[model samples]
Target: MLTLLAQTGSAGADSQSLAFFNFITTHWQFCLLHFLEFAIWGAWIVVLGNLLNARGFTRKEIGSIYACMPIGTMISILILGPLADKYFSTQVMIGVLHLVGAVLLILMARTDNARRFYWLTLLYALAFSPTLGLVNAIVFKHDADIFGGLANQGFPWIRVFGTIGWIAAGLSHTLILKKGQPVNANPLLLAAGLSLVLGLYAFTLPADPSKVALAAADAVAGEPAVAAVADVGILQGSIEMLSRHPIFFLVTFVGAMAMGLYFAFGALFLEKTGVPPRTVGPVMTIGQWIEIFFMLALPWFLGKDNVNMNWVLLVGICAWAVRFGVFAIGKPLPMVLFGVAIHGICFDFFFAAGMVNANLIAPESLTATAQSVYGFLVYGLGMYLGSELSGWLNQYFTKPTTAADGTPDTVTNWRAFWAIPGVCVAICAGLFFMSTLGRPPAGDGSNAPAEIPAQASEVGE
Candidate 1:
């Protein structure tokens, strides 16, 4: 279906048909690039906690390991985004990042020490963080229209293959990699191998460098306009833009708080509710699959004439609250599994919708920075705080009720731990409702009455 979509165009549209064919033929390498890129992360990420526990790593350290993701994301926002935009091709940068991450994974495989593991993982995360944005930039540059439906269609199709790669990795671990119990090495090896493949393949993709327009502007001026512009302190300009919109900051804070709470206990909730370790991977994968579906449908849904962004976001928050509530109540496994599907609306509506909202409000030149800011809030500040809180809560709520050997006398007080996030969600939802008392701006690409700059335009060429 994707191949057909990539090859065909409207009737009598010979030029567009040829362009579509050329796009597919030329960029076919991206399919493999993305496949391996995500395969590496997926191989172990969902199961890392189990692996750490098996190794007898402290629960606190395990939580800290999860914190690596957001911490890396935060660092990338501050340093990598600007550097990539200024100095490197997005494809090459991503390739290098993955290669470095692969090395770290290999090193992690060789280590039995927990501290060494944590330090190496953090390094790997730092190298890996910037690539997320770089890859998206590369894809969007090829198909510039943010609102163009075809661009949305192509990327998700490529990404879905990544999920397939993840499922393959999961099954490999379950069947071949581990004799019986879940082990760390299998997923790490799978991730490392795929990372190397992605790194090598990336060099072959179309070279997409930073500052195309600025470079063009420089060439016309014949005196390095980019250098002069950089010298004038662009950081200050971006910072000023952010300061003018206090509401964006508040939104970011709220998002971070909610996300932190979610990540801290989300998986633990399931584990306590009687879901087995083997089933966790499949259940989480179901959520990713659902998210891909929502991403495919998002442009259509948001583009509808009377769609309210706040309402969409509210629905997502409600889904999130219900998802946790279901887990808290310890429903049957199938019902709990069905609730995982809410991830599509919960994640997409919050993150993707927030990204689009930011795009609608930021200055054209600051689009990358604005996106980076959002990433910083969600992954960096939000997840870091959340992870720590989760670790503490996990220890606090889950008492050691049995000896090392299996025993029937064990008991767990799960309700209080689960309810903390529930209350947080309800409060955040209420705050959001109050903040957007008036309906969200229609999907006409108009900014709300908020003090957004006039220079920001939709990059959907």
Candidate 2:
């Protein structure tokens, strides 16, 4: 009887293993698409500011340059996203934009002047921002077709490959360029090469039908072609929710600023604090590597039985404070790395979970509008403000000085610089914690399991 039960279990395991193997074999193209998509970003963004500093640009200049990406993203949502929804096939648009972006990246690598670099980076951002959304759209379009009811589960498996691609890019950048070499444009050049490859490869991807065709079909059936321009009601409702939920608004806004500060300076901070220049990319990637595990475990934390989103978000916000606090202390490398290792918690708990909370706070009819409001507030307005503020702080903490050998240079009070954001995030987390002490978890105040957005789980730098 025992042997019979053991054989049954063994057979089940074997069947599951075979099923997974088949799944991978069938979906390899989508996996590769997700991989190259992020590889293009991870290659250069981590170390771009550091490279600019090595070339003598000021912190303010670096901050301004970093701000462009968010600006471009905001613009794309207004223009490119709508246009893609109405006109172009997803894959064709992706291929053309990336191909154009590759040329812009190459130009950005060759240009040394900060202003010229700024303009080129903005242009590259405009060309690249649409692809992020487009990639997800195409993947979902196909995922629904392939997996039907299980598309959500299937997505994470393929998307994990993008994180791996990011990790690979970081390690590869370190490997290709040594610490002793001039911190030249090698990172951008590497990104350009990858972008070129992905551009050509995109053209060959499975063609998802254009959204325009669907809209046209609906029109022919005497349905509304568009919703007719008034999100006014939805917009008004979203604003009212934000006003009513000040804790939610404040916490999300502060957390986003913390994210902005990290993206702007985290790589440069590591390099400044005795991490080798070449190894900065890899060290920065430690967070992303940790991100994979935390993101996977997120559903468990946010399970229906848990019902403690306030606690989860507080912990995430506090993790950022800890991350910056350690960077300010800037001591034993292991502790610093520990701080970096917790980024998954910081991102997944705060930002990813916050998306669900946003969905819950708004009425069901206004779900999409609520998300758009949250994205605009956090990724758009919040990130832009935070980037600019971080740059200003960098400038404030930096001063011109002379080295021991008499070379003129600038030195930043790194401890002071890191402390500001750390303290700010800490204060926000504390306030949020205190506010939530007696309240129900963020949601509609019911026991329904929050429908977590698949896109929210996606890892980003």
TM per candidate:
0.78, 0.91
Single out the weakest 10-residue window by summed lDDT for candidate 2: 220-229
For model 1, what is the alpha-carbon lDDT of residue 166?
65
Model 2: lDDT of residue 130: 75
Name the lDDT value of residue 278 in candidate 1: 60
The global C-alpha lDDT for each of the candidates, from Candidate 1 onward, is 0.62, 0.78
lDDT, candidate 2, 322-408, per-residue tens: 999998999888888887888898888889888877767667666666666667667766777778888999999999999999999
RMSD of each: 6.9, 3.9
lDDT of 1: 0.62
Q: Choose the strongest candidate by lDDT.
A: 2
Candidate 1 lDDT, 166-223, residue by residue in tens: 6566555555344445455667777788888888878888776346653542222212
Task: Tell me how candidate 2 scores on lDDT.
Answer: 0.78
Candidate 1 vs. true structure, TM-score: 0.78
**Clash count, candidate 1:** 1
